[model samples]
Target: ISLLQDEHELARIVADMPWSKIDVNGLREQETRIRRQIERIENDPELGQLQTELKQLNQQATAENRNQYQAEDDLDKAQHAVQAEQAWLDAYGNDDFDDATLSSMVSNLLADAYENCFGASVRAQDRPKLIAGLFDHESETPFHTRALRNIVRIARTRIQEIDARSNQLRADTERIMDDYLNNHSTDDNTVMASVEDYRYFLDELDELNMLVTRAATDEEYANSVKKLYMSFQQLNRALRTDEENIKEQLNRINSMLKGQQFGPQGGRLSLDVTFSPIDRQFETTLSRILSKLEDWTRNASDNPTETRNAFNNCETFVNRLHNELDKIHDTNGIKAYGARNLDPRVRSSFYAIVHHDNAPDERISSTGGKSGGALQELTSFVYGAALIYLLGGDLTARPTYTTLFLDEALIKADGRYTKRALAVLPRLGFQIIVSAPESKTAEILNVANRAYVAYKDPSTDNSYLQELDSETITQDETQPTTAPAKPTTEA
Candidate 1:
């Protein structure tokens, strides 16, 4: 029974084993291929031919082998001769150096040679031949030999003179450079190092020119230029202070805006700026811009470039400061009014809170509460007045058409708040036209210049407006009426 149980377990394992489908016909085809390959090997054509040739070669081996050394020697000699002829043909094939290129090279060499011979020079007819002779004396034509010798003689004399002048010039340049460095940057290691860097830049620029000119293709030239650009950029990285400058400028502006003291009614409106350095990962780009501005500012007068780079830099700094200030929203550490009535809409508005004398440091959500409501209304009134002040000129200095059309004045406010709003608006240079219920009409008319009542005429079923004088409004009970009713004298 145990053996049966073990067999059953083995059967289960086999059943669970991963298996793949097999093609029976494909296996049969592979077998047939193997059989055919075996048969072909047994009757190989090349093997049969080699076997036949082996027998024939063995019979003739002694005779042929006796002359094999001599035959190989002759064959080697013939092969060598063929190789020599091919090499000669290849050596004399179409010239890689074209006439135009040769002439241009010779002209450049002759120009230098002439420059060395004289302080400044002109090209000669024999210059190209003279240079070609120096390179290829084996092919020196009899006609050019005299000119070549004369050129060599002249070059020898000129080279000595040029070497002497070059030594003197080098000494003078070294003296001048030393004097400038000592005078301008003797104590400043940083400035001296920068001067050294400028010298290295000039040296590298000459090398870059050589590299680009010698490059065989446009692609090669472009790559060389890119490499030089990258090398120059390394110096830029060392000299950059854009991030620090920007930070300093922003901090200064923020201090000014924050510390600015306003007169009695400025309402503590101070702008605060905060910077996230991480967001300024584009410091490299900013550095390049600032670097260009610095360069332009330095050479602008001499180079006929615009001198407004200073102004541009100032503008950029101010704009960046503005952006940083914009990112920040002011929050005051005052009381959170209307705490009980904090709704979702009110909660979202908690991003910024207002503080005034009455509701100092109160959450904007407080606007929906009892005392908060009055403050909120007052805030709205002040905000509208501010808009008018901004749109118009200064109220005290110059008069403007400062008119406010208010619909439903002091909505849901009591008499005291209504009366206060009416009193404050006019003093702020606002002529308010208020449309409200008959109850608040009396309060609105107290400060209004000309009051008008809009009503629907019952008989005509059309809306019509009629102006009302303050006396007429005041004569009708303390509150005003939309329209006066007819007198019922007979009744």
Candidate 2:
């Protein structure tokens, strides 16, 4: 255990060490293999014992290693370069990624291209998932395929609790978003977010509903899922025509591939005007053609001359298909992509607040006199969901929103309302405060870490509202006290 810990720690330090000064590439493989062997030592106990035997062997190898190690060795220089670069990155917060200074920093960071020096670090804690995510997200789809794969597993896990009410709500939302476009096909601006909104919400609902079906082994995870599901209820639903969007895309692509009508100027395959829904067909066909062309030369040659001609034809076909795929465009200039947008403004360090604080409000106009308060509330709710996402929970679930200052709402929400709300806060990791004439806020504050009260001093000539900071103190000296919650750190 001691050797393993020390080696792992050394690996981290070496991995972080700047490579600019350590110019040798020869020892790189050895260094990496050593780390991998150490990790496997834990998995294979026999290997652990072997490592002890190998320990002495490695020292002997090192002694003989210097015999082959010539003066000004590359590995020795690389080690020094890596250490120097580490100090440089440390001086620059490890990421001088801003515009004005970014290029200079990046050029310096990537100076050792021969060594394939990457400034990134895979900290010991994140090594496993970091490697796995890299492998899962290897292709062009980025995280989408991985997400899609995960969505199924997650949905199946929570399939049971998707009760009739939830299903109906989802179905209704889907229908309004799809066939009707929020029941306002004639009016575009009348709708706020589009069909995409509904699809994403439905996806979230499906994921959470499944989670709710089973008894979540982790309480925190369960609460997070529930919070997300409740928040998802506030989103626009595009109700899908069917449950298989991926299948639909594939079918359309296959259909378009079959429909490739060849004949006119340079044999251009004109797209059918009615091909609105089946656009994926064109893309899939081109991709397939490109893929087949790569193997054209691998086939046995009929005659050398005949084979050369065939290869040329195949190359021409591949090039044309590539050009056609490049020409393909969406009306909105959209392109095929996975959904892993990481807009910083939409997130904060540790808080992901759901929309402004209402149920889904689908109102179109602020100018309309009859416009409801629901939209405003829904907007707040969306912001709240963004907050949840920002805070590292599923967007469909709520995080620590229980730290609510329900000044007026508490008076209206009776005991049961307050009870359920209070119950949820602790589960979701929230603290609640209600400004009621009764001591509701005070009551909860007693169990809280810290609290404050504000009042207007009317006795003075000029009245000003001032807040008096308050701290929670123990009433019992003999009882063991719970530790206060600390502010969360970003993942």
Best by TM-score: 1
> Could you tell me every candidate's TM-score relative to the true structure?
0.28, 0.20
Residue-level lDDT of model 1, residues 87-106, one tens digit each, is 54575555674547565655
- For candidate 1, the lDDT comes to 0.53
The alpha-carbon lDDT assigned to residue 181 of candidate 1 equals 73
lDDT of 2: 0.43
How does candidate 2 fare on TM-score?
A: 0.20
Best candidate (score: lDDT): 1
lDDT of 2 by residue, 72-133 (tens): 48567556556654654475446645556556644443333312211256455443333234
Segments of candidate 2 deviating more than 4 angstroms: 1-281, 287-291, 294-372, 393-491
Model 1 earns a TM-score of 0.28
lDDT of 1 at 198: 63
